[model samples]
Target: MATTNKTGAIGPVPFMNDGSAALGVPLAGLTGDDPKLWVRFYQGTWVLATFVPAIASIQQSFRPRGGDVVIASIPKSGTTWLKALAFATMARGVYPPDTAAEHPLLRLNPHQCVTNLERLYSAGQESMIEALPSPRLLSTHMHHSILPSSISKNPDCKIVYICREPKDMVVSLWHFCRRGKPDVSFSDLFEAVCQGTSVSGPFWDHVHGYWNASKANPEAVLFLRYEDMLRDPAGNVRKLARFVGQPFSPAEEEAGVVAQIVRLCSLDNLKNLEVNKPSSASQPFANDWFFRKGEAGDWVNHMTPDMARRLDAIVEEKLSGSGLSFA
Candidate 1:
């Protein structure tokens, strides 16, 4: 028998050892603390592990509607922040001082506020999706290729995609992966990221896929950059509001609704909130630090020059004809 680690439940089922060759795929590579062995899905080019086969297969059947609003991004690419922004925008009518303590926004993480395609396709999710009211708000990390076929074909559905600087994305992903699997070293993480070996990676492809979609179907897809949001949140919020057909009113604008939304979802504000910091309502990894350091250029502090150059080369090569450049 193969010696398994303490977190063996989370480890990959080695393809070599298994007799069911028909069921097993070749190992892509080892990554993260558990040295998670990865395998490519036959249906999608994206790689996941044997442990989460359900999550992979279940995600395929998820389809969003014309009324649905989805905040999409690769992992660690400002997903949390964008989720908060989208939730706040959608739920603007029932915000602070007006909504009670038991308000959905107060009680839930942005993830809870927005449905995930993967969650929707899981065994228990059919009822959940059916129960959700129409004009639903959702979020996803699925690549363009794997996104629900219905959503891509739907001309009326509005999809919002947020992109971030690849270097900063690497740093953020490193921290996020480290929290759950503390044994993963930064050096190893960086190499995996550079090699496009992380979950939902091949980073540039993820961004380019959405970017092209946004361009090809501007009416259906909206693309926003993290740096742009940081620089001019109000401007972007206004733009988003318009895109989603919820433009702020003169009274609301004068009352500083945009600023209020920004303050409510700020990293400092959300981090300090009781709901975000070790609360009963929070998810397994949910905590103050989950939204830690929502800045663009922090990668400069942690990434060495050689690593940065390598990442730049990767980005340059992948994004050569895309016309999109990281700031």
Candidate 2:
């Protein structure tokens, strides 16, 4: 039986570390001061060490059905916002994004509505995933290179990946991390990101893995930029619905369904919901932690001119030949 935590969510179960040392899944200790941030080097990328076992299990056990859609991204890169948009897009038929009074999104956090795939596996709730009705909506921070063959190789499974410019992502991540450990210096986090040791990082590699895949198989992988979404959300929502094989009908479009969805999932609308508000005593990070300044270029407020140029140069160098410029 899966244990439930104080927040009424399934609790994570401890995984047994058998003498599988010969498997070559070596762990990387990035921050000796904080074991929580330690990572494991797997398949040429760094992932949080705590999630290695669950990732392994997911690789071996997950069976993707034809309609499964995975929302993929690096952390703090507008994941919550994308989740809201995608969920609202996909479930619009049954729960009208504009008209429904009891839509699941209105009452549940986006994370609760579309749970992270790794978290479900880690919590011994894989059965919950299997039980959920299709077409299922899932999210992940894992690099595309490391996803299971059932998902990465399956032509039937669709991946919608969103990424932000490295500068803004770094700023958003630092603020999110500081929510738990208020004393963690921004410089340390920034340095960890620069060194490619931050969780699910080597930011360039993480972004390129999907960028290249989307280029290779445009139909299966939909690559979106956070800045682009911010600029034209209604257009993106239509694009999202179309990619997931649920394009809006002419009647629905004429009725302004697309505009309604864009408004329903807007950051301001979601951030203010009671379900997303913070309750410090009960939950370590209620949905509120995910709702920060949802604007691009906020990095200028936190990072100095030199820091921005340094990170931008590194990103430019790494992504030079890939045709995936953040400039």
Candidate 3:
């Protein structure tokens, strides 16, 4: 069973003597962030964390609407793709497939199109998020258990979470961390990742949070796998549409609406866009950071046989008997 912190927040609190300390408290002798973060374990998951004003503000306030839709994921687990698909899925008639010229996906990075809950608090935009209209579109890396009570209890809210194969996810996250400059060595990072020492990880638990939620409340939370989505995106897109309560009409399907969304959100097209090309003001990371190889087995080039085996074992063990398998 998991425990609560001093703040009465439920989660995996690391090294808590009696589980009474507040979450996100900075500590010594840790090279936590990628040179800038003060990492913390809040209720058991990692956060690109800050304790003072940011956490204080979010913890005390920040309401979520019941009609909201959340694109939830562990970082680098196809967050951008999911956001684009969700926005495009909802904006179908508004932006229309052929009128991609005026589409927001054409103008803004996925991060911008869908506000990130954590980043909103970090950047002091909690009020803005709260003010978003009904049926808000947002994203979060928070585990399902730790999400605000307003969101978690809102029977009307919907969460769409996507997870990737363990090996591919780790590989992508490593490359993502090292993208802008030298941060952590891949070898060092690999061990830390396998040990579940990254933000919002023990990735398997993160996967299971929404996976179990989806099983328990299929209408409220939808769990999707990156591999499955990649293998059959149209079917997945259809699933997304239905989950979001915006299924395509027969007329829309006849107009190749499904095909357009898949093509429009394709990595190849997204990467080639000027907005996602190496530099852009709208992007927090390099536009290029989000566009690594989207293939599932890219880990082969990076992981040694032993390392690969280690991750495979962990994935198997963590997901064992849980009705979840990434491969």
lDDT of 1 by residue, 141-236 (tens): 777766666776677678899999989988997788666666667788788678776667677878999999999999889999999999998898
Best by TM-score: 2
Q: What is the lDDT ranking, best to worst? A: 2, 3, 1
| Model 1: lDDT to the true structure | 0.67
Off by over 4 Å in 3: 1-35, 51-59, 280-283
Residue pairs of candidate 1 with colliding backbone atoms: none
Clashing pairs in 2: none
Each prediction's RMSD over C-alphas, in Å, is: 10.6, 6.8, 9.6
lDDT of 3 by residue, 1-327 (tens): 533322232311111011011235322323343334446766777665553345446556856655578788998899989888887877664566567467777766677677776666666556665444445687888878787767766788788999888888888988887764465567776776777777776787888888988999898888898888889999999999888777888977898989999999988888888878875444346567888889988999998999998998998998899888756
lDDT of 2 at 98: 73
- Cα deviation at 139, candidate 1, in Å, is 1.0
Question: How do all models score by TM-score?
Answer: 0.83, 0.89, 0.86
